[model samples]
Target: MTAGSVEVVLRRAGAPDALAAADVWLRSFAAALPTVVSPRSGDDVRQYFRDVVVPFRETWVADAGGGGGIVGVMVLRDDELSRLHELSQLYLDPDWRGRGIGDRFVRLAKERGPEGLDLWTFQVNKPAHRFYERHGFVAVEYTDGSGNEEREPDVRYVWRP
Candidate 1:
């Protein structure tokens, strides 16, 4: 619930959080991935969060208690056929970085997928690579930017606890 002195309440995301979560996702993406081009517009991302992520995915959000808005979001998805649990999405408000909130999100992902978890990050994002590696994830695969919407080279990382 509380990470250090910060009273952040992490909980399953509800429909009401869709908008705020989308905002955080938008801002975080803009701040963290300035070089990568996104195909979707801001409204498109908002609509996706409202229509799909909140209702369908195993979505979680970090609420900055009191009047503060949702500061973080994480989504987990499972593939029953392959038994793969993917950390589909994780992002935080730019201002909330380095506050240990992202670490909490990673811990939750590991707990939710004790068997293992897989995620992808752009190769250019060294900070993300370090963060994921520090959390026990190892780069297992690399792609040449053709498969993803962003057309950016990515590395797949897997974590086994």
Candidate 2:
């Protein structure tokens, strides 16, 4: 999709794209969660996507137009809430982070989601907070570290359109 001045294609991913998508996801996660100890290695993340995420969720990838392989991925879990889709994961290669690709992802969610969308991110991810805020998402809830696997405080943001 044309996100700003760039033309990246966003489409459903099949079995073949899993590995590359997982690598991008993992890299984004590791960089975004540097303080979290025991970050999963790239192999482990790929396995998780192949076994857990792909089997249970909808996966999409962003192609970098020039045949360069995927630079972004998004995993969605629909109906997690009564009327909202849960944005399970959204990651972009560090090289592509500041570009408007992320704004493109947010727009895709708004257009394709049933009614609204929700997502969770670590409370310390202030940059994410700003990004979401700029996209019209509002913080709705906060949770202590106990419930999540990483045991890190988290915030939930919801967007309705």
Each candidate structure's TM-score, on Cα atoms with residue i matched to residue i, is 0.95, 0.89
Q: Residue by residue across 39-153, what tens digits does model 2's lDDT show?
A: 4667888898888776667888888866457899988777644568888788998878887778887888787785889999899889899999999899999999777888889
Task: For model 1, state the Cα shift of residue 50 in Å.
Answer: 0.3
Best by TM-score: 1
Clashes of each: 0, 1
Tens digit of per-residue lDDT, candidate 1, span 56-134: 9999999987746699999999967558799989999998888888999999998999999999899988899999999
| Colliding residue pairs in candidate 1 | none
Residue 63 lDDT in candidate 2: 84
> RMSD in angstroms, all models?
1.4, 2.2
Give candidate 2 misplaced runs (Cα > 4 Å): 1-6, 65-67
Cα-based lDDT for every prediction: 0.92, 0.82
Give the Å shift of residue 12 in candidate 1. Answer: 0.3
Sliding window of 10 residues with minimal summed lDDT for model 2: 36-45
